[model samples]
Target: MIELFGDATGNSIRAAIALEESGLTFEPRKVALARGEHRAAQYLQLNPTGRVPTLVDSDGPGGERLVLTQSNAIMLYIAEKSGTLLPSSAVERARALEWLFFFVTDVIAPNAQAFILSRDSTAAHGDAVRRLKERAFALYEHVDRRLAERPFLAGRVFTLADIAGYTITTASESELRWEALPHVRGWLERVGARPAVERGRRLFRSDA
Candidate 1:
């Protein structure tokens, strides 16, 4: 079984969704970031960086071992290893990777950093958050257009691209006006309606 270490939020959500999409059985070990569990000696030994969502693959020659860190890396690893939720065509696969990068760099990272850095003061970081939100909206508009043309980001079927993008983009729903981008709004709903996504979400809540 795959062992995932992270709380049910942000990047951890991405890893959970990907694992569900891969149809693999896994266990989630929540490293409560707020409670400083990530900084504890046990977790630091596995992840020196003290980050969440460290995946441990237990099928190693000796025993279980940490396989990967970083949400996107874990997503790609699950996709490639399971040989599912990825495009069969070369062009589609490339498109999937492109969209994955676009979501991580353009949408997730900037806004997340802004929120994390600005968690203490509302006024001090207002301008930074506004700029980040604007950039996020612009990126969402681009995604909306692409999604309008295709059923999913990578062109046709549901893939890791959607898992990555949807997981991150959905985080800012309350802050973002997705209604302005009707196509994106509808796409997000459909993506979230999947049984696997729902199951993943349910699993997370149960764990919490």
Candidate 2:
């Protein structure tokens, strides 16, 4: 069985979404951040970065157990193992990876900044916070335009890129202005309506 160590957050949500889409049987092990469980020595040994969302797969990599950290890596690993959520064609696969990395490196960066600023705020950080929000919206506008051409991020098919972007943006919804990004808003609606996505969103939820 696959064992996932994580809390309720965008990264964990995305990884859970991938697993749900793959129809894999896995156990959700919450690494509580509130009580600082992620920073504990034992957990840090599994993930040196001391981050939530570590995936341990029993039947992985030549029949050996595998330990994976990083949400994107987890998504890709699950997709490869399950033969799902990735483009079949090489061109499409490259495109999918491009957008996935874009979501990781560009879109989520500003959102992360906004989250940090909100969590540790000073009157001095007001302008910086606004700038981060604006940057995130700008990237979303670009995403919206890209969606105007294709139903999903890479192309007509729904892939891991969609899950990666959708989860993060949905988690950070309050900080973004969604009205101006009509295409993105509609795309999100399509993604959110999926039963697998719904199940993944509920995984590790505080109420669940």
Candidate 3:
């Protein structure tokens, strides 16, 4: 059995979405970050970094157990295990990976740093936060351009690239200029309408 320990954060949501989309039968174990549950001894044993979205596979390779951290790594692992969420063609897979890293590094990283800066009270980081946010948001135009040429980020079919792009796009929806990014707006709507995406999004909800 697979157990996914996570909260409702973007990284956790991404991992949950990948598991759901991969058609994996997994249990969602919510870690209440608000209550500092992630820092508890039990949880820390699973992930020393005390981060959300840890994956525990009881039936792993060679019939052994596997514990994995890092949201992107977990997503890729799911793809490899399930033989889905990635293109079969090596060329297409490379494109998928390209866009996946684009979202992970170019988009999500800046916004994450901006979020941290915004929360820091030791010094005034408003300007820095603004700059980071601007840098991240501006990259959406590139996504818009890419989407204008194809149905999905990588190509015709949805893959890990879409999964990565969808979560962050959803998180930053309000900040995006929808009117100017018609293609991205359309892509967002299409991806958001997936049933698995819906279920995955609610996996860590308080009511779930």
Query: Which candidate tops lDDT?
Result: 3
List model 2 lDDT by residue over 1-208, tens digit each: 7999998889899999999999989999999999899999999998999998999988888889899998989999999889999889998898899999898888787778877887784456777888877776678888989999889999988899999899888877876777778898889999999999998999988897
lDDT of each: 0.82, 0.88, 0.94
Candidate 3 C-alpha error for residue 165, in Å: 0.7
| Candidate 3 C-alpha lDDT tens digits along 1-208 | 9999999999999999999999989999999999999999999999999999899999988889999999999999999999999999888899999999999999999999999999999999999999998888998888899999889988978899999999999999888888889999999999999999999899999987
State candidate 3's TM-score.
Answer: 0.98
User: By TM-score, is 1 or 2 better?
Assistant: 2
Per-residue lDDT of 102 in model 2: 91
Q: Give the per-residue lDDT of model 1 (tens digit) for 102-131.
A: 888888888787877688664588777788
The parts of candidate 1 lying over 4 Å away from their true place are 60-64, 206-208
TM-score of each: 0.91, 0.92, 0.98
Best model number under TM-score: 3
| Model 1: ten consecutive residues of lowest lDDT | 199-208
* Candidate 1 to truth, TM: 0.91
Candidate 2 residue-wise lDDT at 170: 86
